[model samples]
Target: MLDKLPVVGRFLGGRVADDAGWRRMEALLRKCERRPVYRAWIGDVVVCDATLARRALLDSDNCLAREPSVWQFGDKQRVPAATVTELNRWLHGAAARHDVDAAARIAVVALAAASGDLHRAALLAALDSVADMLGFDCNPELAAAVRVYIGDVFHAKLVNAPLDDAQIARAQGLASRVAALLTTCDADLPAVLRNDGVLTGAARGEVYLHAVLSVVGASAVMLAWLACVLHMDTVAGVDTSADSRAQVFTCKPEHVALELLRLWPPASAHGRRVLKDHQVGPVKALRDDDLVIPVFVLHRHRDTWPDACAFAPQRWHEDPRPAAFMPFSAGPGACIGSQFEIRWLAAVVRQAATLGSLQLVQVGRSPCANTMFSPPRCRLETP
Candidate 1:
């Protein structure tokens, strides 16, 4: 019965971690313009082809694609189907009746807290609570991770472990700065993010997580300051001409946000398990085989993007290929937080544009590729 299963169907069952195997798969993707489908194996499962992979991803019915669980990590265990269904129903209902953006923010925060990045999780949660009037649902897993991520950041332990002295001090400093910024911004633009209605229970939880992310972001800014000092000269010529130099310094924070995302994507890659025997152009995949989709590689593919390696904000002024860019993956498994992120980026950029020249002062090494959000570490000094 297993042998008869589609190649793609088998990918659903096991873990796949083969470097060379993926290279071979990429070769197939490269040559697949002419053929509609092909076949391959992820372990014992036979995937039909790349076309099928794309189709499966695009099709909502055959595959079960839903918002990632707030507490789950990795492929080790599947979220109980019933729990996922219940969560989805609640989320959808909340989105329809209440503030969707607030809910989404909470979801991301909850997920981050579960990810073991405590500092970020706690800060985001606190910010959300204060700014959006929302609270986070305190799952045990989330609570434990939050403690680990924000040890010593807050006086009261929201998580199981206590943050050390250094972390606590850092957290306090960040919270103060973020609160000040939010106050200034709120006072300046009351109409943009108005708090009109009472937040639902879930909304409250979401706000808490947002606070955590904001605080974490402040720390990241300090780190970015250090990187800027070291690489100042390297990026100097990139902004040539007096006009461009002026523009660079005056560029809105949104532009900076975009540059940050392109430079350091949050999630390194997205994975999928083939559901049936299918083909993607020329490559063949077996049923249940796992397919590792590298968004970084696709984003920087020279053929797909002109000057793929360079960081040029102006490039966005032109039309970009949809397939080549998957900072938020395409099709069914795409990120639900995309809209919130875009809105936040725009707000940040708009604020920066109005302020004086924002100079980056790098303080530490760039963040390693882990966690869900890929923010740089630096400080901004206006002159």
Candidate 2:
């Protein structure tokens, strides 16, 4: 079983805790993709071929692959026979539910970012209360479990505390109350709230937590990256007020997040089992075989992104990248929290750019990538 697997297995189970491991994984994929054997696999299953990856991402019928068992049964089913059908259904339903929560989370984060301290506290508490009603822990058990699984799968050392039910419950209650208050005021809502798909009854607390973590964590990383960019740009000793004009650009945190997605995406790869025999590129995929799509490689394809590895927010300034940039993925299996993540990240960046000076300092090793999603590590000293 995944839980019983060694450290590497646990890490692969998606509980990544640090940036070093993530970088290592990125390096490994880069190296592997260059080899012919690996390229064959990439072309056949991993979506390294730009055309194939895009097609698979956009065409629902061709891309409709079964969900991985880990998501449905957790680490417990790693040793046993698990039904792909059940896993697929669970994943689809979960993704839909997550999308709705994502919007709400983004709204709360944005409101907090724009408001005064008192308003921020009230909004945060309301958000916590809603989370409690939905059973989401701010610090979730799934995150920990995913971490342990990733550690075991990747042979990486685990580096997070076990899930704390009491703390999570308390945090949820506090957040929901704040969220409710924020939503009660029409002036505080984002434009997305008026859309049909923006909110759903499926907005449970667990999904809300996931949405919050996704946005907050991504924002934290982009903020670090932004500081690095600012420092590099100012190396010639130009007087750059970290606050004024920068705030204008900062308000669109989604833009910063889009850049981060292009740089170091949260998910490196995702797997789907072929429901029926299919051919991708020159390789034939058998039914029940897993097709591993490497988002890292696909995102960095030179054909899709010029200077693929370079950090350039200007790309988003031009146009949204094609479906090939599957940071949140595409099609039916796409990440539900994608929109919320964009909103939350934008809010965080805007806040930092407007209200405070953000200095990125190395705090400790980044969390080990024990989960499928890896968040960077850095300390932001605000002055």
lDDT, candidate 1, 186-244, per-residue tens: 22222111232232232322333333443333323222221332235433113323443
Whole-model Cα lDDT per candidate? 0.38, 0.43
lDDT of 2 by residue, 1-383 (tens): 01110124343322343444555555645654563123232333445665576566555676455332232211222211232333233334443444333434543344334322221222332334233222234335433332222222122222333335664444445434333433333331232222223332222222323333433333333333444444333211122344422533643556666766665555566556577776776667667665656676677766667776655555677676676677766665566446655654554455443333334444434433444333323334433
Model 1 scores a C-alpha lDDT of 0.38
Shift of residue 116 alpha carbon in model 2, Å: 24
Give lDDT: candidate 1, residue 225.
21
